[model samples]
Target: MPKLEPEIADEAPCSAEFTAYDEEHLVTYLRLLDAETDGADWREVARIVLRLDPAVDPDGARRCWESHLKRAKWMSGYGYRYFLKKPRGS
Candidate 1:
């Protein structure tokens, strides 16, 4: 039930660092996907889900949501292969 922290909100497009982070924050990514799928407002998602204030940092919040959402899509489409390669609890 861990939540995304404000400090590490911004996610990279792709990288070893981001891959590791994505694994740790998989739940957050899933939540993002769910929100997007449900057509939730990015502004609301930013404030409630991401614990960010779009009014204070609109660009940063938007970038954070978009980047994480993009990575989440990547996980669904291709990044799941990473988990397949390494068995869980290995």
Candidate 2:
């Protein structure tokens, strides 16, 4: 008897693009409201934004995250722990 396996093939690799993210960080903060499951876990988003400036006030960041998420579609239908799946787009 022989073992069978799924065939895999070599394909083109993806290359990262340098978009000068650091040199042109957005000074404006934004957020979106999650009416579906949560008022919006703005704190998590704020912490991520603070990577640009550790000195950034968390409360302020939460405000910004709220504003930004208000425009997000998923934000309106999810809770604090909700996160959009992509690639496989689960």
Candidate 3:
């Protein structure tokens, strides 16, 4: 099945707690992690996964990619605990 791409923000939310935005972008985070694991270039990831063209907006794309990748790492490391602890069907 094809995944639906969500609109991205210029920067991902940076909160100590997992955020609603995080929940919405779970697939995106996973894709980012997978891309990193696969040794994909940041520019390619930005254009393909993030839907941002680095050539057109290098700084914006870089910022978005960096912030989201950071958040994605955080999600993999610590934020998964939040999902584990969350009550079902909230």
Q: Please, what is the TM-score per model? A: 0.80, 0.28, 0.92
Q: After superposition, how far is residue 39 of candidate 1 from its true place, in Å?
A: 0.6
Q: Please, what is the whole-model Cα lDDT of each candidate in the order they appear?
A: 0.74, 0.30, 0.91
Per-residue lDDT tens digits for candidate 2, residues 1-90, read 111221111211111321122112212111222222445344554444333222466555554444444423322334212222322222
Most accurate candidate by lDDT? 3
lDDT of 3 by residue, 1-90 (tens): 114588899999899898778887899999999999999999999999999999999999999999999999999999989877877776
Instruction: For residue 82, give model 2's deviation from the true position in Å.
Output: 25
For candidate 3, the 10 contiguous residues with the lowest summed lDDT are 1-10
Kindly list the per-residue Cα lDDT of model 1 for residues 1-90, writing each as its tens digit: 224552455654575333666666677778888999899999998787677899999999999878878888888788878756865675
RMSD of each: 2.9, 16.0, 2.4
Instruction: State residue 27's C-alpha deviation in candidate 3, in Å.
Output: 0.4
lDDT of 1 at 16: 36
Residue 69 in model 3: lDDT? 99
